[model samples]
Target chain A: MIAVLAVVQGDIGIAGLAASGILVAVAIAISLWRQLGLERSLLWASLRALVQLLFVGWVLQFVVDPDDPLIFSVIWLTAMIGFAAYTTSRRAPDVPRVLSLSIVAYAASAVVVLGVLFGFGIYDLEGRTLVPLAGMVVGNSLAATVLVSRQLLIAANEQRDLIEARLALGLTAKQAFQPHLRQALRTALVPQIESTKAVGIVFLPGAMVGLILAGVAPADAVKVQVSVMYLVLGSVATTTAVMSLGISRELFTPSQQLRRPTQRP
Target chain B: MSSLDAFELRGVDAGPAGSPILKAIDLTVPANGVTVLAGPSGAGKSTLLRLLNRLDDPLAGEIRWRDRPLIEWEPTDLRRQVAMVFQRAPIFPGSVIENLRVALPGVSDERAGHVLEHVGLDVDLLDHDAETLSGGEAQRMCVARALLTEPAVLLADEPTAALDRTARATVEDLGRSLADSGVAVIWVSHDTDQLRRLADHVIVLADGAVRATGHLDELDASDDQLVRRSVGAP
Candidate 1:
């Protein structure tokens, strides 16, 4: 199938890569015409992605084979999860020890979801299966974590008076936070749900389209895409739910009283 | 109704340890009459009310209710027994009746209407939206909500400050009625006129400690500057 796609689409050699410059020039042109002042950021982001992907491809030369040792797969995926967590927690400043917390979230979600896949014999626990699967889980979980944690802090701060008022009315800490937790979960999950809802109709998803272009049958491609979508959704929901519960618990002291360390002035 | 007869705070220091807002506060809130806590700004009057409900624990010392330490009492149980009405009325997003029913489950519409009447609000306002209420109306709504809990003691922090003179008079009468009905009314007020008119017992606080405690007339004769300044005695 790879050979067929390479024959049909032609090799994406160095010259072909140079041809992609036209897209960048178009972006630069729009940036100039609109005076958006985003030319620098756009240029930097494009260059960074180029360097990062090329380096990843070079590194994959040594590790892409499923025959590679499982130890290498575990170590590599752990590093990827660490980086994903760091990036996600950066967006949620109010979350205490956010980096460590995100690590726990991403690792746990990836483990359970990947374990289920392994149990089903979909892929062995090696780099070929582990890297891509972990990528899907970690990347998608980052988005959900950022949304959930940000909304959690925002709700806690914006609704402190209401929450404390509930607490004042003889409700426990968890009961007082029920509304805020509900709001956070709703906000975090809606985007993923919407994308899944519109998956093929609004736009052909990247994974399915790629697989079809690579000469997999259209039905086969669709099945693989559906599986990926379900797996990613499950991973994200688990990450968000776990983190939300933990963060809500953090909002209270050991004595079950609210601790407003993140109260906005 | 419960065996708890009063709130006892013995050397009950609160706030942050280094600079406590309420320091060594030894007093008892007996389950009767109006015990008015009076002070100038920053005297920790609101903190005292919060302590009664275990909103925050003291930095040191103990607050007991019914001879049991407040920390030992379940917070929910304690709060139900010691209901609080904030200064701004804590008007939330809901209908008036929903606000009333949030704290007290299964509060019948008739009972709700009765409490609103006691707070000088018409039962017709039951369907009125909480956000649309006037300041006085919101305060009254909160009071009616607190009353539904059938609190053994009501701790109000400037509950009538938002009310107009007529509304304030009505709430004052309501407080008197609550006291008469055997609810211990612990009203925190800076308004000397209100204190003089309403307080059966006055606690004058200054620098986060009680400067004086006695009858209103007796506090008016106190020589301490905290008492003299707060009571406004010439």
Candidate 2:
């Protein structure tokens, strides 16, 4: 099985990949039979993912140098943050200036968590180690930012009258939104918290499996995986706090009246 | 009389539409009295009540609280002195004591007992889940929470709308007692009987403008059919 997959990974590469197109065909056929109306999206998503991942793989061969870590990371991460900001904007398309807000929030959180880890020599500063670990942490935080921003906006909008009632009763905006902010952060953190709980017992996470597959010692892989889990969790919590607090500020005017974006316009 | 005014709205423009919920109309609420805001639906009574605490700022005029612009005061600070209860009261989750403590931390079990008494609720009810309270009980809890702050002015937006008649009377008596204690109570009620029982001064609003402002008899004597239509005719 190892020898067969090795040949498939090497000499039969393009042809081997082309044969997997059959899977997309089968999925589209199933969607058609079910009248799911998802055939177009399913096809586009599979093809787009294939092209994007292949392109990134080709680019990483040159950029993943152990000797030069800082330049590509700074450049690559700026681009990743741009895309993450756009992804977050989809969650709250009506929120004014959501792109800039998301960029600032996500980038600040990623930098702080990844920075401290590498800066303390807890993780090596090599390109291969820093880039991959930073990618995982930042990627996890992006999901948290989207969920936290969406939940905060919806919850705050729904509770405007009640929040205003508190504001009218002498609670500052900070105090008024404390409950809502906690609720939003909890919702965003649930995925990470559950994954952290389930990682070892229910399933081995991808990073641990990948490290083990690369011939690292199993004990060593376990330690790296634990570090990765904590990094991702810390990244998510920090990102959520920054974004939720910033977004909460925007939901009120200078006079402290709640401002809800009721429509896209 | 002007010196005693709790709030004075001058040429205020506010509301949901270009037409505004309240147009360029002026009104004053006398301090230490039950000023009933009487109007038909959509006539901006609630909008007026909200503006008193700067829940929203007026579009193009001034709202003065005790001779200073309402905006001059920090909104949270102003709201502390000018607290409000809603048409449907907000009962936060947790025990009733928790909800009170959210507003006034270190509020003693003793203080809770005392404040609940002001709203006519027994002290033992404080331990119940606030979310489990009956509609009237929840509303009174809101009132009790507001009174705990010792507000000089209380805004009640149809506080008894969801209550049974006995609950309505309990709330009305509470408002009366609040006014007697010199909290300048600005209340909005659509119920004509509630108005008669509670209003010390009546301000009639129609089409986002003040149609009449006077004692109930003076309101009855005024020729504005809009006032009689809002307050209900003899």
Candidate 3:
């Protein structure tokens, strides 16, 4: 565990970690001053993040070792994808087959991204690089995947008359649903695209900032950050595409009728 | 089934489970002339019209289109032969001609103009934006779009319900003319005036069941007061 702390330039001892609690204190103080009613939520979220990150950090020690079998990295990536899919389904329970569709989206994006990074020799084929890169890809794509799924469901429910009108005109479900699917995909992808466009100017991204804080040269950090940004964008696009198309298919019957989504209980 | 029948329903039950909107409905829609489905709101007139085009299916029993079971016909093919026009007249975001092209893609300008004319719309309105049309014109345009498929039957679910009096008359005339042209017009109307003017044959529905089926003259002469009142019979 100490070696894990040493992987970064300097170890943040227990005292340093406690000292960082001042930031949370400031956020809580602001919430209290504003009467925002977010004091309990802020406290709970901070504690939750601390425990979750520490657990992840402890687990990464064995897996992130370069000497460990690459299988460990693959297993870690699989678990992350599974959890992402589960979270997406939980967020959008109204979407039919969301769990399976999300799995396809996350798994496909992971393969495309990691394959490009390693196969193209952009990053070394080791658990140390593979785990973090795949983690970034999955974590970044999870929100977008959920957005695409829920957006399509919203489109189907809200524009049902329009869809049925198209269906009544003899258009197949796929043809009738194409416009809404495109709209949902656009709605899901735009946030990520805008974030990518404004990455360095508007706000420094977390990965690049973390690297710079760990004493990496700014130029080298920029190179890694640019690659990571591109991969995140690519992964988001791929995941949303898979999710929108797959969910669109599920929203219809084989007879080309749009299946009305049942109201969530 | 009579050869002149367009749709034949036997023991049909419909609507969401446990609360059917149509129940044990045995009826036949004629292959020619206007057949108005006259009922109060929630009487399942729209639901019955939806069944004719396979927009919906009965929970029980069978529907036959032109003597063939509805389940046996491909849904898209069925819809092509039996097109529907909705009440709100949902206009796709495009020109009038573009909306028509949705029913028959690659529709020529001449054919588009002809269908528009058939619906009493001006040929010049072809290039006009569909979303900008008045309520009457939009409903007429929807009728023209359905006509592009050259359907044998037109299921109009209260097609003029949202229109002003003049617009309602125009769409009513369109329905009458379409039926005169040998397209079986299955019209749903709650307006008794529209019923008196347009119903060549009437099916009166109440509480999700058929209360009467006959001509206005015969229904007016019925012993049942409800049947007489449903058709607005004097």
Candidate 4:
């Protein structure tokens, strides 16, 4: 516990930590002054984020050590994937096999994205690069997976007659569901694509800002930011594609008949 | 097992498990002529029709299509043979020809025109956007799409319930003509006048059970008051 606190204190000195607290205080004060009814939530969320981030920082100090084996990185990545899957399953309890589907989606994106980064030697093969890169991939992919799972299920429910009409005309389940799946995928992916398009022009991304603040050259920071943006976009596309296809299969029976979704209460 | 029967159901229980809509139904659908399934709302007429094409399976008992169990046939093959037209007339996002091609992917423009004309639609509408079609035109287009598969049995589930009187007459005539050409037409109609006009055989359903199964004359003479009333018999 002391070691973790020491590490946190070294990274952000006590005065810097207090300065961050002041920022939260300002947010809470504004919430109260405006009667937004969000002061309590704002305070709680800020405190929780502080604690969680500090804990993660402390853990990463050891995990990213030069002496540590790559197995520790693998374990950390696996744990992140598992937690992401669990979170997605909780968010979409009605979707069948959502836990397994999420696991596959997150893991597939991480592997594919990380493989390109390291396989092509864009980044060093170490805990430092592996953990944060995979974290970004898993984090960005989570929302896309949840969006696609829910959207596909919604399409199945709202477009029941259309799907059944196609099925009645001797179309296979895949054929009947192709259009809806494409729609869901588009719905899930468009925001990511749009953000990717507007990344530098609209506003600087976090990674680029962090690099620039850390005194990296503007051109170097831009390069890293562009790579990160592409990876995030790729991860979103991969995760949504896997999730939408998996949910599409679950929406039908082996007989190619549309299985009516259990109505949400 | 008769060759004349298109579908034979024995002790079929359908719908949700605990609260089935069609309960213990034993019936036969003829392979020729128009058979109108007449009932009040919630009588499971549509449910029974769905069972014939394997859209929804029965909870218990068996359904045979042409002496073969429904489960034995490949769903795609079975559906191609037993095409259905829905009430709302779902139109895909394309021209009328593209919609027709959903059933027969390579359907030629000439063949598309012929089928459209057969359903009382102008062939000139073939190139128009399907979503631009009027409700009646869309419904007839759906029928034309079903016919593209060259199905042996045409299941019309309240196909004209949404159309105007003129449009209803047109669709009803199309069904009649299809049946006259030897394709078994199983139609569901809440309108007693339509039952009187198109029924060569009538299956009167009430609360999921078969109240009467015979010609319109037989239904008119039914001892069950609900059955007689279903056919609008005084």
**Model 4: lDDT of residue B124:** 99
Give lDDT tens digits, candidate 4, residues B82-152: 99999999999999999999999999999999999999999999999999998889999999999999999
Please, what are the lDDT tens digits per residue for candidate 1 over residues A1-265? 1111222443467887888977988998899999989899889999999999999878765675656677777887889888988897778877866777788888889878998877787655567667878889988888889998988887777777777788888888998888889889888889999999998889999878887766777787777788789889989898998888888888876555777663321
Per residue, candidate 3 scores C-alpha lDDT tens digits across A137-204 of 89999888888888898889999888999999998898889888888889988998899889889999
lDDT of 4 by residue, A1-265 (tens): 0001112212557687888899889999999999999998998999899899989999998889878998999999999999999999999899988998899989888989999989898888889789999999999989889989988888888999999999999999999999999998899889998888888889899988877666666787788888899899989998888888888888888888888765222
What residue pairs clash in candidate 4, if any at all? none
lDDT of 2 by residue, A233-253 (tens): 888888888888888888878
Total clashes in model 2, counting residue pairs 3 or more apart in sequence or in different chains:
0
Model 2, A257: alpha-carbon shift in Å?
1.8
Question: Residue B141 in model 1: shift from native, Å?
Answer: 2.2
User: What is the C-alpha lDDT profile of model 3 across B1-234, one tens digit per residue?
Assistant: 246466888999998767889999998777678889987788889989988888777889999976689999899998988899999998888899889988899999999999999999999999999999999999999999998999888899999989999999999999999888888888999888899999888999988999889888988898987777778878
Which candidate would rank higher by DockQ, 1 or 4? 4
Fnat per model, in the order shown: 0.57, 0.82, 0.61, 0.82
Q: Model 1: per-residue lDDT, tens digit, B113-211?
A: 999998889999988899998877787788788878778889888889878997788778888888888888999998888888888888888879888
DockQ of each: 0.64, 0.74, 0.70, 0.84
lDDT: worst 10-residue window of model 1 chain B: B1-10
Docking class of 2: medium
**Candidate 4 residue-wise lDDT at A182:** 91
lDDT score, candidate 4, position A36 = 99
